[model samples]
Target chain A: MAELTYIEAINSALREELARDRGVYVIGEDVALGGPFGATKGLAAEFGERRVVNTPISEGAIMGLATGAAAMGLRPVIEVMFVDFITLAMDQLVNHAAKLHYMSGGQLGIPLTVRVQQGAAGNGGAQHSQSLEAWFIHVPGLKVVMPSNPADAKGLLTAAIRDDSPVICIEHRALYWTRGEVPDGEHTIPIGRAALRRPGKDVTLVATSRMVEVALEVAGTLANEGIEVEVIDPRSLLPLDLDTITASLRKTGRLVIAHEAVEGAGFGAELLAQVQEAAFDYLDAPIARVGAPFAPVPASPVLEQAFVPGAERLAGAVRKVVLGA
Target chain B: MTSELNQQEAMELLRTMLLIRRFEEGLIQTQKSGISIGHFHVYIGQECTGAAAIALLEPQDKIATTHRNHGHLLARGADPRRLYAEILGKAAGYNKGKGGTLHATVAGLGFLSTSALVGGAVPLAVGAGFAAKQLGERCVSVGFFGDGVLEEGVFFESLNMASLWKLPVVFMCENNSAGALGQSAGEYPGSTIATKQLIDVVAPFGVPASAVDGGDPRAVRDVTQQALARARNGGGPTFIEARTVRWPGSRPLWPELSTGETDVAFAWEPDRIPMAHRDWFANDGLIRYVRQLFDAKLANTKEILALDATVRADLAKAMRFAIEAPYPDPASALDDVFA
Candidate 1:
């Protein structure tokens, strides 16, 4: 095992996938220049220009081109710079890529992976900072994955590249520099499995992407107070591991869903509905959702800090469920 | 810039065009009888463009076409019975009834997909060409779209990338508005593009562009050959605007069989043609191709009539088979979503 940053793990995964499969190729804007956030660092030079291609600032064309290539027996891993910009390519992603295999009656298999970043990191403004994982998880054909750390990042990306379906790998920019222990060789995590950050028995705290960090921090603080908290990081949102969350709910009897997206009509709502449906009698208290307010991410750093839900907001929600304060 | 199509190949081209024409004629009739449901488009007026151009493609080459995709599919030798059943949403269809008329695609026949959305196939062809280049294959990819494709921003984006990357692709834009007073006949039902000439839109990209009479099979065949040759040689993409006169049948909001099934004899005996749709027959590319065949002594009236008769009989069988085909199992609707 080695300690690598989240971005380094992602870059390592791309390098390994390219080296492993001759059919695998990378295409995106500035991807040859190692991408906007260095997720593709040192990949273009390592794989050469043919395998790592750079396209113009055309999201729709990029998505459509990747879809076509994937259907034609090439495993294309495309980068869209940011999740917010994916709105431009939604037709190709939602209408074409998400529907091609089904529409073609199993004649076409799109083994495509789209890598994009989100979160209110560096006060990047509303256009770049918003988390849009909620939009993709709703798509049927797509498998949505959000890695919380370095190990999951490398493992999940490798799985996505090898999968037969089109997968969307959404990374949080704030966690790129965070250091974590990642396995040395050939690490792969299943698409729908949930990872338990901390095993406990009082409250089941569920989080996604960067919000997993907040859940862990709040759970650690609560641990010192003799309050046992179970932290569950649902790595893959689309093929959700509801059984794990429900199993934890059977013990904890309380649940709190946390994410960087808006609290209203976000992935939290979907999770809340499913959790209640599966384990309605397991609840000792009403579920609490910790997320940003229903508004665009602000430009100012201070406003952005207030806009994004952090450890304190999650801690408050945890305290409400446990301490009843 | 030459096509060495032998007499046999020439007859095969005519047979494919006839099949496309008869299949569409049957579809129009079926729609009229309120049997075939939903909104569907046809390739009645621009048969020569699809048949001649696709005739030049090898079996290994890839194609990305748009909504009016029946002709392209048939030209690639798609079985009419399955294609007919696909249009009728039957289990024996090409796409297992999942994709009806608009999205019917033959994956094994190099047509892995045909987008229902306008201009969606251009970028797909770019990717297909990219894959071919990566594999070091000499096969060229073709994007068959309408003139309305030029209105989409992705069309420009796709062309720019194909030229910059030297990707082997042919952007075949069928402009069936030669007599529509410059008004496009599809999507918005008018030419709303700001560019005066559609070919001029891709001029700044430095790629070679051509404008040919979409009616002339040999002329369309020659231009398509030139573009395909350039692509196969790694010379990059070529945009060919094949212009044909829009048939009166496609003029209204809903397609009507205004010109009727097609009369091959009108090419030889123009005086006997009906006056109401005379302009349509005069501008019809299929009729012009037949006259070219007659003038060159490549085929006689008896031979052409025999070919049409065979196509009609086959189409009649295919249509009956499709009409009697079963609808897909409702439980299998969720299948193929992942694979």
Candidate 2:
């Protein structure tokens, strides 16, 4: 194991994948320069320009090129800089990449992994700070993953690169610098499994991505208040580990789902529906949700702080569900 | 630079063009007879561009084409039986009834994929070329698009990156002065600037660009050869705009939706050309190619007629196979969504 930040873990995963497979390469805007953040820094120096390709500021072309390269027997890891900009490449990602294997009658496979950082941080306004995991999880052919810490980040990225399907890895911008212990070499987490960070009996706090960190903090505070909270991080959103969440809900008899995206139509809603269906009668209270309000992320520090959900917001939701408010 | 073709190569080119023409004709006839459903775009008048450009591609090379892709697929040696089955939405089709006329792909034949969206395939070709470069392969990738594709932002982005990386790709624009949904090129806004010549738009990218007579298969073949050679030799991409006419008979799926006029029309009778307007079928690529074959004594009329008969018979057998093929099982619809 090695102590690394979330960004360092991602960089390590890229380096290991690049060294592991000849077909694996990285391509995206400013990727050679380590992208806007430093998640891809120093990769080009080690791999050379041919493998660590830097593309123009064209999301559509970047996505289309990656899709084609994947279909033509290459494993391409594409970075979109930010999650919001993925909208520009939706045609290629949603229409072409997602549908190629199905549309081609299983004659082709697109082993593509698109990496994009989301979550509001550093006053990065509406455009750059939005969380769009729900948009990708809704697509049928896509595999959506969000890692809460440096460990899962490395493991999930490795798994995504090895999978023979199109996987979208959503990394939270705020968590890039957060340090944690990650397995050193060839560590891979299965795409559809959930990780239980804490065990509790009163309520279950099901979270994703950055919100998982918030839930962990909230769980600690709740425990001091004598409200034992279970924290479950669903690493992969599409093939959700609903079984684990349901099992936790059965034990806790209450649920509070949390995410950084908007409350309405977010991944929280999908989890709410699934948990209710699986363990409907186990509820000790109406399920609570912690998410940003239905407004765009603002640029001002105060508004941005208020816009993003934090440990206090999640703790409040947990208190509401646990105390049956 | 002109790439000389032996008589056998020239004959093969003629055969490919004729085969595409006949294949499209067969599809039209099948559609008319109510055997096929859904919309299809035929490469009727612009056969030479696809046939000739694809002829220059090596087996390992790849090509991504637009919705009007039957010609490119056939020219690249995709099986007619499978293509016909796909158009008919049969389980035996290339895409197992999932991709019909608008999205058929035979990956084994080096025809990577086809896109119903205009200019969608351009960036894909760049990706394929990038893969080739990374793998140290000498394969060159080609993207066949229409004149309307120039307006798409992705096309320009593709060109910029391809040139910037010196990727081995050839952007072949089959300019027929028309867009999708049967809109005239002149009718679209900024048509004057975009449609005048493609070289002007690509010149800013510092890539070699040229315009050629798309009607003559040999001319297209020579130009395509030069571009492919440059790409294979690590020279940057080349943009070739082949000027041609959209076949008058290439009507929309719904005849009523057609604008009652074609952007370019050809005269069926050669003798009437003198009195006809210069734009009235100024150059029929198919006829021109056939004339070259006869004039050069590469094939006599009897031989040419026999070749046409063979193509027709083969298409007839393909249609029979397609008609007899089974429909996909409803339960299988969910398969192949992911590998």
Candidate 3:
């Protein structure tokens, strides 16, 4: 294992996948030039211009192309640059790529992975900073995965490239520079399995994407306070690791879910509803959820940080669920 | 020489055209009889375009077509029994009733996706070409869409990328609109494109473009052959716009059998042809094909009638099979959501 930043881990995943499979290819607007965040840097040189393709700035068409290529047994990984711009390719991703397998009577397998980054930390304004993982999670045909750290950023993406179904791997912009040790080679984490970040007895905490790191921090602090908080990172959202989560809830008897997206009608709501159905009897206290407000992400760093849900809000929710305070 | 046809080729083309024409008409009749297929588009007037263009394609070549996709599939010899079953939403359908009339993809036959949304599958053809090129295969891919597809930005993007990357794909635009662009009597509703000529749209991308009389099977076949050759030779993508007058039976909304089930006798019986839909019959590609066969003596009127009878008989059995085909098990609806 080596210490690699989230962005470097992702780049490694692409390089490994491209090298591992002749059918695998990378396509996006600036993918030939390593894309906007440099996750695909030097890939074009390594894989040749054919495999690491740079496409025109037409998200709809580019997405359609990837979907078609995937249908023909080609594994295409597309970088949407930002999750916000994915709206332009919604038809291809949702209708074509997602539904093609079922619609074609199981004849086609869309082994396509769409990689997008979401977070409110960039102060890139409302258009660029919104965490839109909920929209993809709601889609029936798509497998949604969020990697909170460098290790998962590599593993989940590798699995997504190899999986038969279309997967949307939601990376966090803020986590790109965050460093963590990733396994050296051929590391693939199973999708739909939750990673246990910390084991505790007082309250169970489920966090997604960047919130996992935040939850770990809060759990660490709360541990010092003698209130043990369990942290579970649900790597995959669609095929949710409800089994691991309910087991955690069964042990702890209190739960709190956290994400960077808005609290209203977000992934938290879905997870909360599912958690209740599975572990309603086990819960000793009402579940708490910490998330951004309903407003669009602000451009100013002060307003953006204030608007985004962070450690303070998570700590309050954790304390509420664990201490009844 | 462009219109030259061998006896077997002419007979096969005529049979394919008749099968497509009869299948669509049979579907309309079924819908009218309260079977309720739900807002399906037909390749009524432009049968020749599909039959001719697709006939040139090898088994390895991929097809991604639009809403008017029945003809393209039928042209490639897709069983009418299964196709009918698919349209009727039955278990024996091409997609096992999952994809109905709108998205009838036959993956086994190299069809990628039959998208109902306009221009949705246009870029898919290019992607198939990209796959072929990357895999070092000499295969070609084809996209069959309508004139309205030109209005979509994806079409332009597809053309630009296909040209830039030298992807081997044929973009076949079936422009059924009559007169200039659109908005004339008996004209098919089409895109209000800024370019006077559809071929001119591709000039900026530097992809070669051509126009063929869609009614003429020979012309459609010839143009498609040229385009396919250009693509396979790594000469890049070729765009062909097949133009046809909107069939009179093809109405403003729901199509009608206004022409009363295309009589092959119209080929010889000029006086028997109705004057009201005269232009439709006169320009009818299938009918013109029959007339050309008679002139060339590829198949006499007697032989042609016999072929039509056989096609109808086959279709009759296919239709019955579709009608009798059961709906898939309700529990299976949850299946194939992934993979």
Give one digit per residue, the lDDT tens place, for model 2 in B265-294.
122334544343345355768767776677
Model 3 lDDT per residue over B1-339, tens place:
225667888888889999999999998888888898987777888999998888888988899997789999999879999999999999999999999998888988889999977788988888888888888888899998888888888888888889999899999999987222235543334557677789988988999999889998878878888999899899999999999877766664466688888889999897788888787788888888889888887889899999999999999899999999999998879989998
What TM-score does model 3 achieve against the real structure? 0.97
Lowest summed-lDDT stretch of 10 residues in model 1 chain A? A316-325
Off by over 4 Å in 3: B1-3, B178-189, B251-253
| Clashes within 3 Å, all models in order | 1, 1, 0
Ranking by DockQ: 1, 2, 3
lDDT of 3 at B290: 88
**Native interface contact recovery, model 1:** 0.80
Instruction: Determine which window of 10 residues in candidate 1 chain B has minimal summed lDDT.
Output: B178-187
Question: Which residue pairs of candidate 1 clash?
Answer: B184-B191
Error of 1 at B298 (Å): 2.4
Relative to the real complex, the DockQ score for model 3 comes to 0.80
Model 1 lDDT tens row, A1-325: 9999999999999999999999999999999999878988898889898999999999999999898889889999999898999998998898888888998898988999999989998978999999999999888899999999999999999999999999999999999999999999889999999999999999999999998888888889988888898999999998999999999999999999999999888999999999889999999999999989999999998999999998888888898988786
Instruction: Please state how well chain A of candidate 3 matches the true chain A, as a TM-score.
Output: 0.99
Candidate 1 segments exceeding 4 Å error: A323-325, B1-4, B178-190, B251-253
Candidate 2 wrong stretches, greater than 4 Å: B1-7, B183-195, B252-282
